[model samples]
Target: MSSWEIHAIKYADRNARVRGDSFVFDDNHDAPHPMDYFMWLLRRGEEVILVDTGYDDAEAAARARPIRLDPVVALAPLGVRPDQITKVIVTHLHYDHAGGLRLFPNATLHMQAAEMAYATGPCMCHDTLRMPFTADHVCEAVTRLFSGQVVFHDGDGQVAEGVTVHRIGGHSRGLQAVRVRTESGWMVLASDAAHFYENLFARKPFPIVVDVQDMLDGFDRLLGLASRPELIIPGHDPLVCKLFAPGVADHIRRLDPGPTGKVPR
Candidate 1:
């Protein structure tokens, strides 16, 4: 029975008028102004696995333009320092997800080999695909790789005892998700495979995805890996906190924790 804690570190917010074709929607809908970015911290005993590193305060604020919040400030209450993180599991190379990588100097960064290649490769020249990334952020990752601080996983691989990384190419070439074996059941963190529950439940892919078919397939794979659907947590959905049971802290959500621990169906 392994115990784990998950925290959502919000960095910024943007008002996005989601159109019908945007993300499994037929009409314009008001969403919670997309939360800038968040990093999920999973703690099991002495192992501190960080999933995604939210943008750096200064750079994110500058790029976001009129930034609403700082991710580091949000993490202060959690008592998590950049240097304290043991491992960083990057879901992708998007600026929002990898901007803060430099902050964790001592942590071993993990990411998909394909993602790193694409991020640093010529495909980044495409307007649609390149708009979301920052050259500086990607360069930092490249530097880390050169320094041997970044560990690239070719496909599916295990990072720790109960933490596994599974590549799901859609949002990005090497986008991956993390799966953890918890006391109650297995929890699959669907990073960007399914940004919201509707995406998964309705079998729809987000408009920002690169390979729509791959995204859909990834969702299916995520579900198959989980012991139950309730054990899956979608990325960028505020309803995540509401769906899963509360953890040690108010912001932390526990995907598996016995009868009272399961996420609401």
Candidate 2:
């Protein structure tokens, strides 16, 4: 078992337009807007793993959209510099998940092979499909791969001791979630596999899914992989911090520092 410290980094905020009926197959109800987020650092021994880099400040600001906060600025309180990150586990290649790759030059990125192909493949030729990501960000990741800064995962692989990556295709063909062994048991970081806890608890599916069946299947897999459903953390749910104990408050929270090592609470 490896001890770990997990943080819920608040990179950007959005009023997610969700359809109530869509989540429940009703197609007649409305779900309220919810918050968007990013995962921060996970420190274990000498390795520091960063889950996702929130949006780049300038790019997000240029959209002239309302954002609750800037991810970089949010990291200031924690004193985490971009280059200090040793590894970055990209949950997916969406603009929100992969936008901050340039921030850490020394870090080796862990991502799904299918995600890379999708972000840079022919499907992106269509405006509707490419609208979710910024071309520049995808280009940056491509450049990083060429420079040998990325380590692509073909499927499920162990990133670190007790930290496993589980491939679940739903939001994207290569979308994956991270499962870390915690003191309490196993905690699943359901990155985009299920955007909100309600989706899993209510047995509903989020509308913006690439494959509806795959998303549903992924949810089932997530539940089986974890010792407890409460340990599963949704990618975009703001309630994560509230659900888990506070170890590192401002930037991220420590869910459980397993038997591997101790993180000062």
Candidate lDDT scores, in order, read 0.75, 0.75
Steric overlap count per candidate:
1, 4
TM-score for each model: 0.88, 0.88
Window of ten residues with lowest summed lDDT in model 1: 28-37
Global Cα lDDT for candidate 1 = 0.75
lDDT of candidate 1 over 65-112, digit per residue (tens): 444445555566667777788689999988778877777788888999
Expressed as tens digits, the lDDT of each residue in 45-70 for candidate 2 is 66678887777776676665454566
Task: Name the regions of candidate 1 deviating beyond 4 angstroms.
Answer: 19-36, 65-69, 245-252, 256-265
RMSD to true structure for each model, in Å: 2.8, 4.5
